[model samples]
Target chain A: MRAPLAERVGNYLLLIVFGLFALGPIVTILVAALGPDDGGSGSSGFGNFGKAWEIGHFGSYLRTSVAVSVSVVVVSVLLSVLSGYAFGTMRFRGAGVLFYLFLVGIMMPTEAIIVPLYFDLRTLGLTDTFWAIALPQVAQSVAFGTFWMRAYFRSSSRSLVEAARLDGAGPWRTLWQVLVPPARPALVTLIVLVFMWTWNEFLIPLVMVTSESLRTAPLGLAFFSGQYTSGFTLLAAGAVIVGTPVVLVYAFLQRHFIAGMLEGAVRE
Target chain B: MSSPPGEPRKVGYLYILPALLVYGAFLLYPLVRAVHLSLFEWNGITLGKFVGLSNYADVVADAGLRAAFGHALVLIVFYSVLPVVIGLALASVLQRAKVRGLGFFRTVVFLPQVIAMVVVAVSWRHIYAPDGPLNDVLRAVGLDSVARGWLGDYTFALPAVGVIGTWFETGLVTVLLLAGMARIPRERYEAARLDGAGAFAEFFAVVLPAVRGEIAVAVTLTVIAALRTFDLVYVTTSGGPGTSTSVPSYEVYHRAFELGQVGSAAAIGVCLTVLIFVITLGVNRLADRSTA
Candidate 1:
């Protein structure tokens, strides 16, 4: 089934070009980070990362981002599994209507709701706190997570559930003891997606928290770039600092990430 | 009476309650409130006056607002159209050659999607700086006259921003289409060759139809990404060089936070939401029809 040698070579050439396009910016930034410090004045190597970490206050921002992402992922994954189990395994009144409501969360642009969401959170005195950033994102991630896990649960082994039920196991026990263990792959995918989205979210933390310490990594990076416009090395190092965790996670769980994305696309 | 697993009793409602509560409180409620706010002139602090549809009217009449929406549409060309076209071409090449390192290519190509948009914007902003790699390359090639600040140039800013979108999105589209194209049976390709169909003819007769659904999915995701582009514009240009790269999402933030035009901002948000819905619905309809 192989094509001619020339065509194969041409394919490789094109793939290489596209690969360069994709990898070029990432590689350049990494290289620039390791080059030197601000204005190329300070010592070279990993010192830039240290300086950027201190100056940008990335330690605080990364902490905020981690806290927000962890809270969002934990709450949303648990909620999505519960709800997805319902939608997948059970047919109840208003199921269709409720599922469509969840779909609206998936489809609704953040621009549509962010303004009111800010005001609403502010009214409750939740703004400028971690809950303000984490809770709203929990809602968003749960929306998509429910949809994703529902698809997984619906196609999961039915006989296992039936066997568990015949043994007098309750619905909760069936889900936890019988089904959830085998659903590790789907759960991992949900965790990865929700974590990435929560980590990379910009506009929410931008508007929700005005305190300098509460700023997430992306927000802090944006402000840092603005402040250090000419400090290319420092800025590049800061980007690496802010971006490395997600990159590392993606490198490890890329299979789940890709599978979830393609599956989501096809289902849509 | 006990119920089957597929038809669990009213307790099913309880299983969904927690998620439904949070979703409604944060997302759904805010959406409704945004629509409600769109109809009034509120300073965001005081009790607002009702302005009826004047905010919507303002969105239509204001030239800058109109231009912002226009920039989003232009971005669709770069974000959705260009990526899909390039993705199709790349997938076809791989399809023909049965590429060996497809897994490696997919991983590298899909890397951009995983990074933060702010990081993407920062990296690209560096590349587009006056003396950045791009201009350096141009000067190296003796095209020094063409070298300029890309994101600072009024005319080039939008496309410069758009090209970044293309770069970030092309990999996603390509990977998605490749997944779709891989499902085509080998015998179909062999049959097409037996019919003496050339590459173009084979693409139209066999490949295009097979991946129609993927194209729609790509368009939906990317078009939505194009319209909802705030982080990129916010980081890269701030809709700068005279609002040349301003988009609705950015305007939604700028108007409310900066200009104190909450009502108009809400109106634009409502419009953007509707625009996204209508366009995606239209895309799905067209895709379904052609495949049928």
Candidate 2:
């Protein structure tokens, strides 16, 4: 049946409003990045980008962020995938209780535990290092990641696992050879989601690492803005530098990202 | 699907061991320590006397913390209500028509979600500066009288920052609502159209009911985020203009890290967690009942 003209117009108008609302801040930032420096002295050019790159010392910051984020994603996905296979495919005593215990981590926001985590890291002598940031994030990310992978695992056919078992495949070999291959899409989805989250994370890194040398991109942006108080163009340039990778990743993988988020949210 | 029998159970425990150990060390242990620390008055570096509920009393008595929490509640309107309404409306629209470049539109809408909050805050801070783009636009459009320092002013700062939260979070809400909308069978819409339902009527009767689950999920997540708002406030105003824009998280950060009042910080953190639990439980229960 053909919809009425008024409805179509109204729908289009609604979409346009939301589209502008979502895109407005980003466009504003992009313009600011390309606009003249805050003093209104220099003409608009790529000058801010060069200054940001030089003064912000973003080279080291970029490396630290990439290392930390990649480490967290790789560790988180591996742990979640293994745990998910066990929980989703195996019959185990106390499995239900253990899985529910993992869910508790999700309910407890990182902010709640960050205070003691600082002290704990200090005692362990791991403070001011990449492990301090990477370890906690991996732990936190694993809760959601495991939950996601578990859902993916549970939805797959049990007959496959049974078939693997009958074919003389041990549990590890079965998971490695059979279950892991089928779970590739879900694994990719989790990796991208976790990568994006860890990349954009700020508070944990800010609280954990006090050394300037160890700052992540988000922390670097915070520090850069503070140091370049009057240099709005440079700050904008820094934001772009920090925000660009995730934006680029999302541009290419929007569907997978959205699907992953929806899957994570809808399950409970 | 129940787990089979005996052998795999051993493997399951081993599989979860690493995650369990890490969570215990980092997440669970710290939480317990935070609670323990809430009972003492100590700087982060040095141990002090046990205060035993005095810190909680201080948090309760402090006007600054209370005001910060009040501001956080105000933020809930921006973070939870505004984006949710906009997202639902947008999702409703997208559901009705297949716009050209819909995928591109979705990408643009979801862009802010990928950007860090610090970047979003800095960007908005510049826009809200006294002589920034917002005021420039206002002046150019002949509305020069209305222009002001959006983040620097006492009256406008919190809402201004809250609006950024709305802007940043609306896309997630939109995506969730869209996913929910997708689950609504087309037959229901067809039936509504055949019954001479107008767009509004059909939306109210068909789409709204179907996406109730999505709405619940969005509100719950957004409310949690609103309560925990810190990065934007930290980057923009640092809860400045006499703490007008301070939220609980910023207050906790300040109390613990900046002032060396670890106990009070933990108290605030504990209180914030309780508040979140209450609010989330209430929302989730309502959502559960509706979907049930």
Candidate 3:
């Protein structure tokens, strides 16, 4: 049954008002990015974007973002898939205890460990390098990714695994051939999520590295806003430049990403 | 979950070794080292004498640390409590409204969840600027006396920062609650109306209890956001206006990086993690009780 017209109107009004509150700042940035600012972008043009692009050296930062995210995803996902398969399909000694240990990863906030991790990386001489950021993030992502894929694999039909094994497929072959093809949704969702988190990571970069050239996009964006304080158009342009990559990814994979997030939250 | 004909193979440890090694080296080892460092008086570089819990003493005694923890809890009021309340209200309204363009509204609302925190902070910094739209709107409505540098005002800065957290969290909580509410049968709402239940009664008696697990999920997520917030606070105020907004995460960064006081930072970090663990455990236990 449908709601009464009065109630329907009230709900839309409420949603639209809150939607404005949610999206108002982004719209503010959008307008400022496109509009004019004194002594920047001349007048009524998008040269602010060009100027922000150059001033922030966003090109280099974007490259760093891509490199770090790609490495983290590849390394984390490979490790997670292997571990997830084992946890899903096989029973080892201390299996329950070990899985609980991995779940600890979810509870430990990045802030709690990053302070000491900075020193550890410096001792290992990995500070100011990509590995410093990527490695810890890879661990974090794999913790979640392993939990995610393990659920997927556990719920898969055992008959499929048995059939593949009966046809002489080893465990590795069964995983590659029988399980993974059907798990593409979970895999893609994990990739998109890990990519977003790693690309958008700021604190690890802020603490771990001081080199300007090696800064990730979000870190570069913060510094750019700090330096270009008087240039609102440029600041707005810088924001869009930094945030647009993840927004694009979200727009493209909205459904899978939302499903994954909700599932993760519900599980927690 | 299935009972196998033979005993379960223990060789699966070999398959998980690579992951466990990475987890141990990067996560577990760092955690252990953080605890170890917390007991000493060393800076980041040098080997130093053990202080034996004095750094933790500093964390307990310091006024600055207390304020940081207080600010984070205040943020929980905004980031978790207010959002959850608002989410429940929204879900109650939307669950029966049969609205068109539901997906579009959901996207617009959830858009903030995906944006970079640095970007969110920067965008909000503009909104709270002295000459920003907020002030302009205040002036237009003839309430110009109240407008100030929100992120700079001592009384308003922490709440100003909390508002941003609230803004980001509301959509997420609302969507989560709505997802849970979707499972409630429509006829239940009709039955409530047949018994002369008004909106408030219908909601509290039916919608709210049905979504207990979701309320727990929302609380857990948002409380964690409040407790562990770093990037947003970093870019916005830098824990400024005389440390009115210094969260534990910010303090950890400031101590370890700026002051190079490694031990106390580790101590505070450990304390913060324990607090989060306790709160989350309590939340889950309470949630499980309600659901069961």
**Which predicted model would earn the best DockQ?**
3
Q: Model 2 Cα displacement at A255 (Å)?
A: 1.3
10 residues in a row with least lDDT, candidate 1 chain B: B1-10
Candidate 2 chain A, run of 10 with poorest lDDT: A38-47
DockQ for each model = 0.66, 0.63, 0.68
lDDT value for candidate 2? Answer: 0.83
Candidate 3 at residue B217, lDDT? 82
Worst window of 10 by summed lDDT in candidate 1 chain A: A36-45
Clashing pairs in 3: none
Residues B111-213 of candidate 1 have per-residue lDDT tens digits of 9999999999999999999989999999999999999999999999999999999998999999999988899999998899999999999998999999999
- How much of the real interface does each model capture, measured as fnat? 0.79, 0.70, 0.74
Off by over 4 Å in 1: A38-41, B1-5
DockQ score, prediction 2: 0.63
Query: TM-score, each model?
Result: 0.98, 0.94, 0.97
Candidate 2, clashing residue pairs?
A91-B3, A92-B9
Model 1 / residue B97 / CA error / Å: 0.3
* lDDT (Cα, tens digit) per residue for candidate 2, span A30-148: 78778888745474667777777887889888999999989999988989988887878777778888888777777677678888888778888888888899988988888887788
Best model per TM-score: 1
Per-residue lDDT of B259 in model 2: 91
- Residue B247 shift from truth in candidate 3, angstroms: 0.9
Q: Residue B65 error for model 1, in Å?
A: 1.1
